[model samples]
Target: MSQEMGVGLLRRHRDFRLLWCGETAGKFGASVTAVAMPLIAVSTLHASTLEVGVLSASAWLPWLVIGLPVGAWVDRMRRRPVMLAAAAVSFLLFLVIPVAARTGHLNVGLLVVIALLTGTAAVFFQTAYSAYLPSILAPEDQPEGNAKLHGSASAAQIAGLGSAGLIGQVAGAVNAMFANAATFLFSLLCLASIRDREPRRERTTAHSKALLSEVGEGLRLVAGDPWLRTLTLFGAASNLALMGYQSIQVVFLVHTVDLAPGAVGGLIAAASTGGVVGALTTRRIAGRIGTARAMLLFELGLAIFALLIPATSAGAGLLLFATGGFCVSAGVVAGNVIKASFQQRYCPPELLGRLTASAAFLNYGTIPLGALLGGWLGTVFDLRTAMWITTAGVPVAALILVFSPIGRSRDLPTAPRPRNDPGYVHPHSEPSPRSH
Candidate 1:
């Protein structure tokens, strides 16, 4: 790393700046769609509560379908091209929605299909992007880089969500999708402008292994490592509870809380400001208290406030919802910053892509199920009842971290244990050559 890239990376590291801008723009667009998609389903198509939940589920279903293979494939190829292709595909898919709506062809089914395709693109983009980050910055600079990127992403999401309702109301809800599509174009341009090049990965014998074999290696890596195992399992559980309530949030606010469409966006945007704060402060907090303690505080302690979400109503009660949302957002984003830095330093570089995919396969796989569960509970009982059930699960789920090995340590491990150590379980009888 050059001196120029040391402390003032944003001003000096041209490639990283480009990557940050592209990623931030991409996050902003996705946030816009998060609000716009459900709004379109409810406002324009007159979708039922169950149908809206299904629409949310459709976006994450691809992780279960293709997440594993995509991770292995990302390992075989350069990451940038995969990201580029995925972005292009997403841009075109989102663009189709407005056109379809204009032509009188938009329906719940079409909306579901678009969500699924864009979700597939997201799986590709996210898997590739995770593996690509460590290649750009030196290990020492990674924490700072991660903080800046995550903070900007949170900021962008705030901007996107804050504007979504205004755009939906001013321009028709269907047409607001144009803003989402345009962001991808901006991201594409930013990515294309980067001049740095990654060296070609030489095709060694390990690279020639069977796809399923490679996938299995990734899975075992997560399963065998106690640290990785704890985090990955907690992620899966946390997401299940988080997504469960989030999938039906819009409907709950609109019907049960009796809030207008515009208020929904404002409340969510306000709550999301906590993510920005968390991202910016995580490194400092971790340095002061140690990463392991920070994790407990962020995931378990702060998450207890989730119970407040179910108490929300039209006027004065809305603050309860925002307060709960803010705490949850802060906790999740802070936990992610710590986890990202840990994984980058702890895992072998050769296996990073597989590790990312395998972990995400478990982590994100539960999203669709959670969405379906939220929808079903709302349909079977009532939206408020569903909110209570799901919101309560948020803190309950964090108990996984408490009982696991993470709770006993003051700091997370800096590196994996040696294979010969009893604490270290190798994925295979003999280590693969690449692992050396």
Candidate 2:
């Protein structure tokens, strides 16, 4: 293991090491599937843009629909089981693709169903992960741990996607899916290896209460807190902007930039490269600038660079969009590290899972809309005009945070909010809890 890694930083803790290794493998496998599934829809199934949109939406739409309820359920049970089961099911789901493709029965409807199932498994994995880490690490180390997870996942997306793209080209799409299936099997093995007794907090199927009330409670904390509220709102706004751009990316690259599909996919892979760099280096850079300033300024720069995309000539659009992607990726990585760290700090471990889920529901709920908007808007207008709309929406994020605390400060301890308290602790300041 790398000594400087977050898990390495906790090298003496055997259980955490096991969990870390498992999550790393799981994240990598998940990324591979995320990339491969889309290719299968486009190539083997001959799906149209509307069909592809449904396939894509199927992946994230569950997060909006069932994320909170699932979070509540996971919080009520042992998370390790949830994690292990998710890995197993994901493996089975991917395996179905190759089987269906071979049988000559693969269709858009079936692909959509598969995407939704895979997405459901992903929700479990993520919900367990969000709650699991805070319990394992001390408050101070949460940021480093989160930074590592984000960094590793971003690298995995680029690496895994790049590899899958190559496989799709070299072999057929059906054969490429085997890679994802293989990854899931490895992830399942890793997850099964974690032997630590799950540590539980105040457990509840909190959703059984009035769904509206539970939602309100989670929303209230975020809305009531100056910092948390700002981060949540900004995050939602950011997702709307970014997802909007991503949804239309293929069209923009194809229609406006005049690139072929393969070239467009490769450009996106290149753009995510910057995000990987940012994730790997978040801790060092944030430590030097303070988390607050780093997040605030980087996001502003991200918006500016996003605006520069539509202005490039068609001949150079690929390069310009690639450069813009670099900035957006960097900003998202850095911003997410700061924001998630801040959230994990002030949130109660008991509320962490459900709260995270509820917040995810709001932020990601807009994503489906963004994708729909991008596809429809791109189809209707000049692709360049759609890009302009996506880029311009970035300011809405800043606007949401303008009156909140995130724009002003950076790091905070990942402890739950004190009962009606007024201050926060930085995780690095009091990390002895993790050494327990």
TM for every model, in the order presented, reads 0.94, 0.87
In the range 1-436, model 1's lDDT, one tens digit per residue, is 3334435888878889999999999999999998989999998999998999999999999999999998899988888888899999999999999999989999999999999999999999999999999999888888888888888899998888877877876776777789899999889888888887777777884477999999998898889888889999999999999999999998999889987777788898888888998997888787776687789999999999999999998789999999999999999999999999888987877788899999999999999989999999999989999999998989988898889777766667766446334356333322123321
Candidate 2 lDDT (Cα, whole model)? 0.70
Evaluated with lDDT, which candidate comes out highest?
1
Off by over 4 Å in 1: 1-7, 416-422, 425-436
- Give all candidates' CA lDDT scores: 0.87, 0.70
C-alpha RMSD in Å of predicted model 1 compared with the true structure = 5.2
Model 1: how far residue 433 lies from native, Å: 39
RMSD of 2: 4.7
lDDT of 2 by residue, 1-436 (tens): 2335554665766666667666666666665555566667666666655555566677788888888787677667677788888888988888888898778888878877888888888888888878887777777777777777778777776776566656666776567667777777887786677667775544345436665566566667666666666676787788878777776565555556666445555666787787777887667777766666567666775657887666655666567877888888888887887777877777876677777887787777777777667666666777778778887887657666545554444444445678555344344432232221
Worst 10 residues of 2 by lDDT: 427-436
